[model samples]
Target: MSQGRMASGNDSSVTEFIVLGLTQQPELQLPLFFVFLGIYVVTVVGNIGLLILIGLNSHLHTPMYYFLFNLFFIDDCYSSVITPKMLMSFAKQIISYAEHMAQLYFFSFFVIDECCILTSMAYDRYVAICMPLLYKVTMSKQDCLILLVGAYEMGFVGAMAHTICMLKLIFCDGNIINYYMCDISPLLQLSCTSTYSNELVVFIVVGINVVVPSLTIAISYTLILSDILCIRSTVSRSKAFSTCSSHIIVVSLFFGSSAFMYLKPSPAGSLDQDKVFTVFYTIIGRMMNPFIYSLRNKDVQIALRL
Candidate 1:
């Protein structure tokens, strides 16, 4: 809640920024810290466990699990990028400009990668379920590799765009970020210079990241659903739905929370709402993925038993 004197762009820039953690209530800090610490522990364990499980099990090396391997990898890295620093913010951490920028860049990179990877997973599922005969040919090792590389390339481009735009902004005023971590919206809110350009970039970049993947998933699932319905046997239909249901749940949770957080105009005094939405994708979403896929997936269950 601290305020700084409004200074001109020519004035001294903020050397560091204070992160006002999830809540200012003294009594809640320790409890919240423990809670998120537990979540982080589970996130690391669940994701890494899945990664190792997939790597060791030769039976799970199809294109679907190939995407799953990368998805878990991204989730692990994504959670690490945000959660540990967020835990420190409970102590009201002060981060240097360089540190904050690094956090921003990496966070942006992993998040965009997650979006693209999820879209690729949906495409993989579509091929596996809707066109079973052509799955291998269409999603060959080389093709899957191309898709994975493309996702990372998009992440790199999006992160660079955001970081470069942030570099142009002057933070000559207050440095307290009213949220838990260094995110695009909260950081933009702290800028002392005109953020019109930054906001435009956020909208364009976030729109493409959110919309394109969403549309891809939507179309893929639509075709998938159509194929599932054509199966005359109830058992076959059920199996097809089962194959896709996990991906659908994951996509819904991730895209729903992320789009809500980024695509809208961040109104003044909305940081609290922003924090809630951010927790869904950043913390809870990552924590839930491994359990969702493992518990729902028969192949993973079989691999675990073996």
Candidate 2:
């Protein structure tokens, strides 16, 4: 709420930032805390359970499930990075610049990793459904590992880019962050210096992260749908659709919420609304992924039972 003074030059006057949290109302604090606590609990339990199940079951060790394993891991970590600090925010926590930068780095890393992994999962589905004969050959252990490694590598590079750009900005005395965590948008709004370079980097990096993976997913599903349409058997068609339905649901939710948050122009007044959108991908979506995949996936259900 404070329109603090802008940075004079390259030097930063502010050493730390105050987090205003999701809401300033005294009444909503306890209720929101309990709600997010419940979300964090479910997110941890579900993702961890899925990770353990995949690790223990040999049948679930294929390319698809391998990707799912990493997905769950990232979701667990992603939720961890934001939710706990979010909980602390209800009590009004202050974070130093170094701490905020660390949060930004990890947050960016896991999100980009999720995008890449989801893209990989789409390709895995494409191969399995469109070229069943070569699924094994195409999605071998080495290939899966390469995809996983690439996702991590891309994540590191993207996170580094965002963090480094942020480091260049100078902050004046208006050190209050309106959101629950140290997100790039809110942090950019706090800078005393001109944020043109930072904003541009955000646009370019986010554009690539969102657009590239989205295109990959679209092409994969297009090919997949074409193959499915050619099949004559009703049961076969339904089976193929079922295999992809869960992924489709997840991709829609994750990409939709994330793109809304990062890709849009962050007018100074939109920070309040940003928190609402942030809740979807940061907490709710992560919590729902395991359920969405497990309920729709027979293998996961079977493994859970066993």
Candidate 3:
């Protein structure tokens, strides 16, 4: 296996990276930049506005919106971590190599954090729909706080694991990352050194992060469905189902795209297309969550109106 080392075989040397901006076509640059810039602006304002509105609205102080306010915060974090760097890539195509990895580590951290938060949100829906009377006791303020802490901790620990593993890699071969931001898979491909440990960590961490929550979400909703079917009143059933549907939409989009990009095997064993998939998972998915989960939500709409 090729080992990443300096020209003098010194292990303590820093490497720089060159980012290939979104599109090489000069004609496409400005238009694409403005388009992404607009998306970033909307993402920031919508998420922040939702968080503030939820916080100020006493009516939304309950467990579910508490989960949502946290969700909005995650959206804000997710966008802030990825989009600004993307915008800067437009201004200057190449990024600082070491700095890019550091940024990527943080971005991955938030992405993992969002996964946990979404799962927590799903659990909130499960409780709301299946056990209404017990909802207060089941998802109490303390419970919500603990879950938020767990979400942040999960993100922090997972990110630390991935970043530490990435830093151990040898990247002397080439430093060109095809994606706009530093992602695990893209960074893995750059290693001139063996990636056995890196790949294993990716497998284990991503598997647990993606699969465990996915299964929990499925089970929670399944139990929820069983409960909903027992309700004889059509109007009540319709109302109950509507609220749960938004989360299903958001979860499906976020998790589905993520699974596709990360799990699929390529014949060429390449990640070029994966970079395109990253945009949907990071940028477009972040934007979609607020729209599907909040903007279109009757509760949020009502909250905003008041």
Best by TM-score: 1
**Which lDDT tens digits does candidate 2 get at residues 1-306?**
233333444554666788989999989999999999999999999999989999999999899999999999999999999999999989856877788899999999999999999999999999999999999999999999999999999999999999999988777747888889989888888887888888888888888988889988999999999999999999999999999999999999989888888777753648888989888888899999999999999898898899
Clashes of each: 0, 1, 1
Candidate 1 versus the native: TM-score? 0.96
- TM-score ranking, high to low: 1, 2, 3
- The local distance difference test score of each candidate is 0.89, 0.90, 0.80
Residue pairs that clash (backbone atoms under 3 angstroms), model 3: 17-97
Per-residue C-alpha lDDT of model 1 across residues 43-160, encoded as one tens digit per residue? 9999999999999999898889999999999999989989999999887578788889998999999999999999999999888988889988999999999999999999999999
Taking the tens digit of each residue's C-alpha lDDT, what string does model 3 give over 244-277? 8988888898888788766655212555677677
Give the worst 10-residue stretch by lDDT in candidate 1: 1-10
lDDT sort, best first: 2, 1, 3
Please state the error at residue 285 of candidate 3 in Å: 1.4
